[model samples]
Target: MATVPSSSEVPPLAKYLASTDKKTRDKAIKQLAVVLSDPSQVTLPHSDMSKLWKGIFYCFWMSDKPLVQQALASELAEILLEIPSTSMTFDFLQGFWEATVREWSGIDRLRIDKYYMLVRRFVNASFRLLMRMDWEPSSCERYNSILAQRGGPLCSDDIRVPTSLAYHLADIYLEELDRALGISPEPSPSPAPLSTLLNPFFILAARTPTKITYDRIQSVLFEPLFTALTPKPDDQPPSRKKPRLSTPTYSNLIANACLSDPKAEGAVESEKLRKALLRRIFDVASGEDTRDANRRKMYNLWKSHMEDEDSSGQTAVDAS
Candidate 1:
């Protein structure tokens, strides 16, 4: 309901933009992020808003200070939820993607917490947008346009999948999938299908087969998720608990995406991928590392899913 700057205060916002001090510029970016998060302020047209975010994005992009970009990207989750329109969200996504491509590995450069927050919001905002709208049509349209839409992929062609971001997106999707499977201490009363819930990542996986490689599939996606599925020692505080990996749902997402992709061959590759996935899952779930009830649940799901896959003649014993 509030405006960023009532008519007269606009000059100060602009002046802050030009300030030489890093502190002043950082504060300006922070305030701009907050202002952009509001959907209620509709005075500015969507096209202009897109450019506004673009301008802000480039400021972060060109800035020598990495902290400034992290500060802006951190606001993405909240802004994603409150953005005025999907069009504008795409602009923000594009800006974020390009900035990431320039050099923004979550664990390496930025602190995990900052990167973690961005991923969590990005994935959730993506899914929420997909679920609310008929993205298939827009995706189809954008694909044919031949003009790259600003910000992340709206369609296959407009899509440019960053490997680092892709893996993190997959991680967040899997984590949410784990929660959706009703494995946690408090599962959802009504859960969405894994395919539906993780549609955004599926779109990414489907589009970016080239970027989503074997090593990344292991190191970035499976390894971290496997670690999370591994239950912590009971002596540890409940606050430190990792997410319970829903192996069955996890298997389902991969199978559905791989099978559906024209690039990914049938049962053979998908099965191999599944087995590789299960192998890591087995090590963590069945490994005698931690003694927690989740280990058994994970193993049981893995065993049952394997049987189902084998019965269908879709199970391949290959490393992912």
Candidate 2:
């Protein structure tokens, strides 16, 4: 038998993590969960965690069938919950985020949906973990900071990750928080403040360098409210049913926060935006003659611009 000399080689777990055989991958993940749940077994540094995430990313990449991918995603996110310590959980999450953002550009349309679901699952799991921690202020801030980081899904610093991921986050955010809070054990936990729940958005709006990205975030966060508050034209027929609103109770709170949160903008700029949005609401509600025509026109133009971008293949990025 010929012997091959070996120096540093691939980690044993990496092979299994990327295995195409379903059982092999599942077994590897379960073992990983155990190790993560017990810090004494393995202490993962940032670099090690990052390397592990590459294999885990491929694990999801190699998975076929939506149902199977979903199951795998849930299992992977659940690993965070299994981790014994807060620091480990945060490290595990940072590794996951870095890996996803690092590889986001290569994801194709066919595989994109699964990855989006994976992001949602991980996001929900994060909230659950925070709830488990009693939503400690420092922990919550750290969590939001990760999401708002330069290469994070929220993508404040660059366009490397498409804004679609952020849009999806905005679309599902409040509902996921509601679900996380609802599932808390009896003698319900003290409510996490609306301000904290909305912090990530404030940070993104405050710090995003591009107008397009800011407009995109603004539309996703507040457009529904604009629709709900606007009155239908007299000539238009009544709708069959009222549309379901998105976190309607928080509508005022979010608006006020956007206007008042010093972190979101300077006092002057915040006042200007506040007045602009308020005027838009009044104009939209009054059903009068072309009062908010410029905003309406600009909004339509932005919509068209987004469509053009999407057609040019700027759709989604995986945060898997």
- Model number with the top lDDT: 2
Q: What is the per-residue lDDT of model 2 for residues 1-320, given as tens digits with 9 covering 90 to 100? A: 32211212225676789898879988888877776786553346666677678889999998988788988999999898887777778988988888888887789999998998898899889978876776677888788878887778875666776777787888777656656666666455444444465556655655555566556655666554334334346885654435555324333323323332333342222334434454433333234332243334334533432331223433232211
The lDDT of each candidate is: 0.45, 0.64
Best by TM-score: 2
Q: Candidate 1: how many backbone clashes?
A: 3
Model 1 misplacement above 4 A: 1-23, 30-51, 54-76, 84-91, 102-117, 124-161, 176-190, 197-215, 218-320
- Residue 181 in model 1: lDDT: 33
RMSD (Cα, Å) for all candidates, in order, is: 12.6, 12.3
Off by over 4 Å in 2: 1-10, 39-43, 223-320
Q: Model 2: clashing residue pairs?
A: none
Question: What's model 2's overall lDDT?
Answer: 0.64
Alpha carbon lDDT at 208, candidate 1: 34
